[model samples]
Target chain A: MIRRKILFIGLLGSLFQIFLGCVPLTKTILSPGSPEDLTTCTNVFPVGPWESVHKIEAVITGGVSFSLLGVTRGDPNKRRLHSFLLTPEGFILFEGLLGEDGMTIQKAVSPFDSPAFAGGLMEDVKGLFLPPPGKPARWGRTADGTRVCLWEGPDGFETEFWEAKDQDRQILLRDDLGEVIKEVSLKGPFVNGLASYIELRASKPLPYKLKMTLLQISP
Target chain B: MEKTRMKRFLFFSIPIIISLLSAEAGSDQEWASLKEAAKNIRSVKSEFLQKRILPILTKPLRSEGRVFFQTPGSLRWEYLNPLRSVMLQKGDTIRLYHFSEGEWKPEMTQAVEVRRMVIAEISRWFQGRFDESKIFKNLYVPGPPVRILLTPKEGVDKFIRRIEIFPGTRPGVIERVEIEEPGGSRTSIEFRKTEINPNLPSEIFEKP
Candidate 1:
């Protein structure tokens, strides 16, 4: 009995050590290749002026609901935009424009506080979908298994690039502080089958989710 | 001199005569019945199709969806084709979703103008009462097709110019609704296959 107990404990120790080793090694494995490897890569970036419909399911702090709609393209830098919210039967609940400085939401049903609500929303959206300006300033690995490249701007505005191993595309982001102020992830064709999903998380939670799907690639 | 006098008399008398005739034709009972129909609708569910035309594009992009509304303050609008999206409103909270995003964002509901318009219209609808004092100056006119024209009052004119509701030949049913905006944008909804006051799941208004 004494010998069996000792053997069991030894086996458990070995297994624990193996798991620890795997976890640390996984971080390194996710690192991007040298600059030369990126140069030789054949992937092309997705350009915009795109539009697509999305079905959103939100579970925030345990509250859950669903919404549906389509979004049209505009530059976050320029901040001009158009989109529509529709019912399952094809009625337009709200329609509006998000422009450089503000936004307007019209024809909303109950619980929707149009113009004021939409203005803040468009700002949050711009942060998430637009890429960082200027240049990348820091390059390193995050403790949580991502290779990161960061760019810092005035007013605490910063952008990050996270790379995952065996993944063809990278995540481009603009953030304020630690919050994910704005971001776009590019998954390789393998994950979405030749299409990409762009996710924009609001700086503050809003009553809507905005997503873009790549329908076709244009040169 | 008699001919000249007669011409002057006819010009002034004709408008007054026409005005008197129209005033006599405007019966209060017809207006009351229309208001009753407008206010009595408790809930509504309908299918919709939206076609977007871009200035540079050759073909309009089309989408089909569904809309649901319940009294006091519950609404669910979802688009099931071309893409999936939904907006659900229950009480003071509204949630919108894009399935591709896989998340629902919370929004605030404090702004008054748009909210008030919606609430006022909905409450009136549930009660089956159409109050012109709140939104428009109501007019009932015989048309190429019979319709009720609601011309917006002062404050409401910024958004809507007029709305026309056409009752079905069968009575008590809304056959069509047309909303005209000040910007020349018009939306016309033709209600078909309507089911009124049907049993609807309470959870439909709850968060998903």
Candidate 2:
């Protein structure tokens, strides 16, 4: 009887371990990574007008969920931005400019202005969809099991790129303060794959989140 | 003595309980009637006071606007207060106008994916058919002011968690609409002086 009870307990322990292993974990932490180093990324073609739908959520300062439909074209040096607002029901509430140098938030559904709101957002999208302008200054491994690449730009912005073992591409951008001003992750660049889904969080107290999904990409 | 006191209390509460139950039933009936009334509305034209409350802000941003819709295909959403902007959908074309530019810019609405989605939505609204199956799961509740809560379908956009629409006791007027996003951003719009089928001009959609 003693041996039988022990075997039963061992079987139960194994079953519990199996169940725990099957449970999926949601990752909230944002890490830095590179585009070419990404294993699971869909091959993003560098060409004309592209559109995408993205699910956006943020929790650093506060929490909000919204989806954005984005359109972009032209080289990274000169890109045009346009976007539309939709309720989760797919109801079109408003249409606004995504990225224009002189955009004014004349009427926002939210209190934040367009430039301050879209500045960090557009930067994230550009990081994911557009290729890095120059080669990496340095490459190394992060303690968190991510491959990192540091890229320097003409402006005061420093971009760190990292890859997550066939999962997604992560990019961390910061200013001289070493504070992460923005972070982005792109999933799937397969043929006809989603363009690039991005999440952008600002360093300000009134930090905002922007999510972008690939709706359609024109060849 | 305790048993006698309990009997007396139960006897006194009977009438109050009956009245409360009757009031609840009446509220349910009223809500059903309102839903029935909404079914007959073919179109609506209303002037709305839209207030957008931003997080960490002292004042609610305000915009006064007018919305006109003709069933199945035509809609004109114009904002005239604080700033001037217009979105007009006529068959296949959508024109977005900004007062700052002082000119109407014709957008390639069909080719643009985002605009196509907008056009598709407006078209659906024209059909007088709410795609509840895809957009939202609705719940109706009773109160002095009726409340309709719309929870989005699963795997939808994250920007909006739920929306509350309160229709006034009177017909053809929506008292208020509250939109709650996942990030604590809320926007509310209140409508006043609403009219239905008021024979608005087609020129309202056509650029003058």
Candidate 3:
């Protein structure tokens, strides 16, 4: 009887640990290669503050779907227009504008006010358009031959930018543990190296994907 | 010369008079009865063009779609060009779908709750309950296709600068809805052709 109680306690401890482990995403293994020039690596990703209008159709799979007109501006890092979130039925969900003075939100309809969702949203948008924090720390290529550029951000986070041979660019924002918390992919029909398709995947906390298709790009 | 001028004036004036009379007929009916008239409408299907003009955008973003609505609660808002998405609502349940990664995927659960609110707002519009919200001041100008202008009150004024509604060719049918933003940008949804009280299958409300 005493042995059974001890085994039950051990099982409960394992379950609690598993629940805690689910907080972080599955760590992605990185392959090393020869260092390359940072400027040559980010040739495909859009830089500078320019407006991009896209038909944003967001789906959560078995939940609901909505298509709206989204306009994103600015470079990845600093102050930028971020992205304007709209609903298909002509309603403005929220207007996210990132200026030099942090970020400001207007017309946010309820859910965006939450600390978790709003923070996650801002991170994803910044991950997709803006450049990583600080400068490029290193450059290399993955085992899949996808060119990788790593930028060491504050608090020991590594933002990696990957580019395929075919001008397709992918961004992986990972923490110190090598867990890719966020992944952004910019893909083809490159018009002067600007991607027509972009997808952002958030892996930690709550996993969600935002896919944006370009309708028009203005320099 | 005087007779010819009088004759021309009469010709234009008669059509104007007739249009005013028809508009008066619409306005003379009680607003509640018009709400009842809206309930009389069984189903509606119309093709629409959505033009989103913003100050940041160099050109207006144009999209095409179809809008479907049924009395007592059902709506299918589908967009075809540029992007494909469908928002369907039947009674209390609302389902939305988008073409993602070449497959139809649903949207976030938050949108479902939002849709419920939107569906309620749309239902109020369908019932012709102009006084439903204190946020808008509804106006009407007499004509063959009467004009209903809705100007939003204070807090809501920033987002929805103005809303203009026009009656359809069919009596008591809605023709167009135009929403303008504060910065001269607007989203104009023009119903090219509209079908009123048509028999739409239940599958029409299902995700396609």
Top-lDDT candidate index: 3
Which is the winner by DockQ between candidate 1 and candidate 3? 3
On a 0 to 1 DockQ scale, where is model 3?
0.19
Give one digit per residue, the lDDT tens place, for model 2 in B62-177: 66788777654677776675445566777766666544334443332212333334444434433423334244555554654556555554443244465666767666356787
lDDT of 3 by residue, B1-208 (tens): 5333222222111111112233343365544555566767777888988877766677777778987888777888888877777778888788777666678777663344545454555555655766674445565655544666666544444445556677675655777776666656576777878888788988888766
- Across residues A1-219, which tens digit of lDDT does each residue of candidate 1 receive? 999999999999999744532232223333444574333222222234444443333333334443434344544346455655443323345566677555777545433345555555455444434444544555555445455555576876555555556554444333343454444455545321223555544434443344555432212
Candidates ranked by DockQ: 3, 1, 2
TM-score of each: 0.52, 0.41, 0.71
Given candidate 2, what's the lDDT at residue B9? 21
- Model 1 ranges with Cα > 4 A deviation: A1-48, A51-70, A75-120, A135-150, A155-157, A163-219, B1-128, B131-133, B184-186, B195-208
DockQ of each: 0.11, 0.02, 0.19
For model 3 chain B, where is the 10-residue window of minimal lDDT?
B9-18
Q: Pick the candidate with the highest DockQ.
A: 3
Compared with the true structure, the alpha-carbon lDDT of candidate 2 equals 0.50
Error of 1 at B57 (Å): 11
Backbone clashes per model, in order? 41, 27, 7
C-alpha lDDT values of all predictions: 0.48, 0.50, 0.64
